[model samples]
Target: MSSPIFTTPDEVEAAFYAALAHADLDRMMAIWSEDDEVVCVHPGSIRLIGLVAIRESWRQLFASGARITVSATHPVRWSNLMTAVHTVHQHVHVEGDDRLHPPIIATNVFARGALGWKMVMHHASPAPDMDNLHSNDSPHIIH
Candidate 1:
C-alpha cells in the first residue's frame, strides 16, 4: 500500500492503533518514520532500533495470529512545527484472555517530514499499580 499523508499527529496515532488491532505490519510500519534511528520498546522487551529490527519484531508478534486490541487513553501532548511528543496509557486486550492486563504507559514521538507526520519513537512499559490509582492531583481518565 502506498503511504497516505497523515496530516496530524492524532491522525497518525489513530492509524497506528488501528493497524495494531488488525496486526497489519505494513500499515503499522507505514506510520513510522523511515529513519534508521526510529525506536520501539514493547512491554517487558528490549528496546528495538531501526526499521529492520522494528519490522521483524512486529512480524513475529503478528505471526502469533492473536487478536489484539489497543486503546490509547489519558494523552498528554506537546508539539512544535517539526516535532510532536505524546504520552498515553495503552489499554490492551487480547482475545481469549480472561485476566485483565495492567495498562501500559507509552510515549510516542513524531516528526513532520516531507511525507507529513511519522512516528520516530515509541517506548511502552507496563504501568505500576500505583499509577492505576486515582489521585487528588489528577483523576485517571480516558478519552
Candidate 2:
C-alpha cells in the first residue's frame, strides 16, 4: 500500500477532515505519523495514546456510520522548522441531523519528517454554545 506525501500541515488537515467525512479509516490513518509518540482525545473520552489506540477509536466511530462532516474554522497557529500546532473550531454535522451542535475546539499538531508533514496529535472537545454569546451584553473575555 502506498501513502500519499503530504506537503504541508494544511494539506494534512484538509485530508484529515475529508477522511472523517467519508468515513474512510484507511485515509484517516494515513494522515498520521507512523513513529514517535502520537495521541488523540475525542470529546468526552479518555486520552488515547499510540497509533493502536487512536486507530481503534476512529475505526469504531466510522463503524457506527455517522458520516460526520466537519468544517474547521477560526484557526490559531504556531509553527517552526520541524513542527506545527494549530487550534480550530470544528463544526460537525451528522448527515441527516438538523439541530446544530456547538462547535468543537480542536488542537492539531503536526511534525515534518521524511514523509513530509504528518499529524502527531489531535484533541477535540465541546465548545460553549456560541448562540448564547451573541445575546449577552457583558463583555466576553478570553484568556
CA lDDT of each prediction against the hidden true structure: 0.93, 0.93
- Candidate 2 wrongly placed segments (more than 4 Å): 130-143
Model 2 accuracy (lDDT, Cα): 0.93
User: What lDDT tens digits, residue by residue, belong to model 2 across residues 11-47?
Assistant: 9999999999999999999999997589999998999
Supply the TM-score for candidate 1.
0.89
Error of 1 at 96 (Å): 1.4
Give the per-residue lDDT digits (tens) of candidate 1, residues 90-113: 999998997899899999999999
